[model samples]
Target chain A: MTSEFELIRNHFVRPTPQAILGPGDDCALIAPALGMQLAITTDMLIAGTHFLPDTDPCQLGWKTLAVNLSDLAAMGARPRWALLAGSLPEVSEPWIAAFTDGLFACASYYGVDIIGGDTTRGPLAFCLTAIGEVPIGMALRRDQALLDDDLWVSGQPGLAALGLAHLQGRTVLAEPLLKPCLAALQRPLARVELGLELRRRGLAHAAIDVSDGLLADLGHILQGSAVAAELFVAQLPPLPTTADPVLARQCQLAGGDDYELVFSAAPEKRAEITALADHLALPLWRCGLVVGAAPGQLTLLDDQGRVVPINEKGYDHFG
Target chain B: MTSEFELIRNHFVRPTPQAILGPGDDCALIAPALGMQLAITTDMLIAGTHFLPDTDPCQLGWKTLAVNLSDLAAMGARPRWALLAGSLPEVSEPWIAAFTDGLFACASYYGVDIIGGDTTRGPLAFCLTAIGEVPIGMALRRDQALLDDDLWVSGQPGLAALGLAHLQGRTVLAEPLLKPCLAALQRPLARVELGLELRRRGLAHAAIDVSDGLLADLGHILQGSAVAAELFVAQLPPLPTTADPVLARQCQLAGGDDYELVFSAAPEKRAEITALADHLALPLWRCGLVVGAAPGQLTLLDDQGRVVPINEKGYDHFG
Candidate 1:
């Protein structure tokens, strides 16, 4: 049997150029950029609950780090370092190799380094802690949104949910949309660059990543900022040309796993944000406006300006 | 049904004065003390592997943080912040309350703060990431042991293992030693102050914490420093006055879970270390010396100055 140490050395240990001291030491030593604060977040993914049993190890690896990176993006921080702790039922060299390859692929893409971690024998699970950096007091926060600020979302919000529905055999994607939807579901890209730019340009007043569906996560921003929101459903980003309008609307409104940035900004910055969208070649959909302080209330309007009553808000893990 | 967010808000959320931003955000923001390097380490504890199913949630919480703090202690770092990611079988509010209480108890004792974490539903497991700080270039390391340096260990090295033995019904401890031994096993304190002092005073050439048995952990230093070590069995710290010499010797030599600091220093610094020990009111046991560069070879000697053969070196997770 290969020891845990050997397994880590074989698969996870890589040269960390940014770290003062990397693996094999008691701790990995890192120096935050001068005049910056470290942004830290942790996330855990478990087998069965978070992913299917037969999910590819490579995708699992990418999604694990990607989700944590999404959190950093939401905070408008630049990715820097990560620590991964994993539990596997047994040691499989090929699986580990592929998983680590996927993990490093995402890390390299975002310019982050895996500094230290631990591996053990148990049910399949992974917990990752990602560290990033941002200038002091410049982090995008949930409580900083001003009343009447325009609400915007990056990319399509419900594609990943549609993809998940397709995977679960509840809905069949059209041939043209199948590949893109599944890709969205399996390999969501975190909006790190856009987040950094938003902060640097002083555009976004508040921001959050769409992990628990738009309505559910938007509720977080509203409650934190002690405000309400009026969303123009007709102006929301279009779903992937689905035939079923009800299903499309459902996924668009309440689907999770989008990893898109939902942010608020002063209405006057519309032209600048539009220019940013053009430069990045990504859509910046203006979907709503922050109403006055009225914690936890969100109103949705139809194309004809009629109120739309929502029966289900979003995905709730324990509900 | 209690949602994951509700659970976190109810149990894990708290005011973190040391952090610029704590929970309720995408990421916690922290500032490292000026002119210091951040020391980071991650550790995972899984059910049926690191602990018994019936273990107390409170003790589990302490042990979880304690182990990670031990790693920081080994590097001579002062712990500052921690992130916890936990997967529980189900939501049990009482269990969570007790666990968080114990976790905060240890955190407050050490002057550390819980900045952020994640909670999910799955088989029981925990992964904690601890971040600390140390003056640049002052961290004690396993690879810097000088040849002919004295090998020293703090506290009783095998009491935790003895407590484990007692828990397993392999041995019965007398009334007087029962509580202390059990505490040693379940709530081992990280030698934070001692480690910081050791590095600040420049008294130790190399350092490691005894998580694995003495012989096994000592092997890490020997291999890392490319040096050999000779340990005198007679000079080893006395076990809790046990009658079973064989079990006592085995526990002292190869038993793990000590969480005590094992360090190397120059013979010329002996007087200073002794005085430091006196000031701290803790025993500093001198057990061996670093011979010359010869990777991975450790010799054990009896009181008669003759070599003693050993069958087991230390705990191997896969062994």
Candidate 2:
């Protein structure tokens, strides 16, 4: 049997040139760059709750780190370091190797160093804490949205949920949509560049990742900013012609698992943001606008400007 | 049914004056003090592995954070913030309230801020990431042991193991020893001040927390420093009179769960360390010396000036 130390050395240990001290020590030491603040976030993924027990180790690893990186991206922080603490029912060298491969692949892409973590025996679960750096007092905050700001979302927000629905046999996706949907579900990319550019160029006033569907996550920004929103259903990214419009609407409105960014910016910056979309070759959909109304209140509008009642409010881990 | 947000607002939310942004945001933002290096560590506690399933919620919460704090203590860092990512079998309000109570108590005592984390529904488990600050280049590293340094350990090393033995019916403890042993096992305090003073004053050449047994943890320092050790068994803290001497010896030699600090210091600093012990009113046991030998080699010496045969090295989580 491989000892814990052997397991760490073989699988988890990697060259962390960015760290003052990496794994094997009681703690990993790092120095945040001068005049920078650290943005820290943690996410716990439990087998069966976050993914199927037999989910592919590689994709699981990618998604796990991606979700936390998305959090940093939402804050306009450059990804820096991560610590992954996990529990496994038993040790399987091949599983661990594949998992580390995927995890390191993501870390490498984001220029993040896996500094330190702990692993123990138990039900399969992983908790990752990611740390990123942003210039002092310059992180895009959720509470800074100005009234009448143009609210935008990146990428298609409902595809991952559609992929999940297909997986659960609730929706049948067309062949062309299957791969992209599943990719969105299993390997969503963190919007690090988009977020950094938005912050550095002063394009966004407030931002949040669209993890819990567009409406629900947008609700966070509205609530935090003590404002309201007017979302035009017609302006949301179009549902695929082959897909069920109602289900896609539901997914677009309240789907979970989308790692897209939903941000609010001054209306005048819309042209600049559109140019940014072309520059990054990514879609930037303007689907809503911040409004002055009761805090936490949201109104969905149809193309004709009629109120559309909403029932689904996004994913709740407990609900 | 209570939503995850309600649970977070009701139980996990706490004032974080130190954080630029706290819970409810995608990430917590903190600025490490200028001219300071950040020491970060992560620990995962799994049910039935790290603690019994029926363990008291309050104590489990305290021990979970304490163990990670112990790691910070080992690095001679001043713990400043923590992120707790946990999975729960279900949402039980009372249990969460009690757990947070204990968690906050420890954080308050140590001057740490509970910044942010994630919680989800799943099997019961927790992962905590602790971040601390140390003066640049002044952290007590495990690789800095100099030849001929006197090795020291703080407080009792074997009581926690004996406490486990008592709980497991492997041994019976006398009335007087029961409370302290159990306390050592369940509520072991992190020696933050001792570690801080040792590093700030440059009194210790190397340090590591005695979590995976004194010998095993000490071996980390030995291996990292490319040095060896000669531990005087007779000079170790005395075994309890009422306990079986042989069993006590085994526990003292290779006990796990002891959150004590074992350090190595130059022979010249012995007087200052002794004075520190007196000042802190904590027993600092001098038990060994660093030796010039093949790296990672360790020798156990009996009072009769003979080498003692050894079998148990320390606890292996995977073994």
Q: Compare the candidates by TM-score and give the number of the best one.
A: 2
Best by DockQ: 2
**CAPRI band for model 2:** high
Q: lDDT tens digits, residues B1-319, model 2?
A: 3466566545878899878888889999999888899999999988888888887889888888999999999999999999998888888888888889889988988998899988888998989999999999999999999999999999988999998899999999987988988898888899999999999889998999998898888988999899999999988998888887887888888999989999999899989999999988888999999989788788999999699987888898887
**What TM-score results for chain B when candidate 2 is compared with the true chain B?**
0.97
TM-score of chain A of each: 0.97, 0.98
Output DockQ, candidate 1. Answer: 0.73
Write model 2 residue lDDT over A125-152, tens digit each, in one string: 9999999999999999888898999999
Shift of residue B296 alpha carbon in model 1, Å: 2.2
Provide the TM-score for each candidate, comma-separated.
0.97, 0.98
Interface RMSD of 1: 1.5
True contacts kept of each: 0.80, 0.90
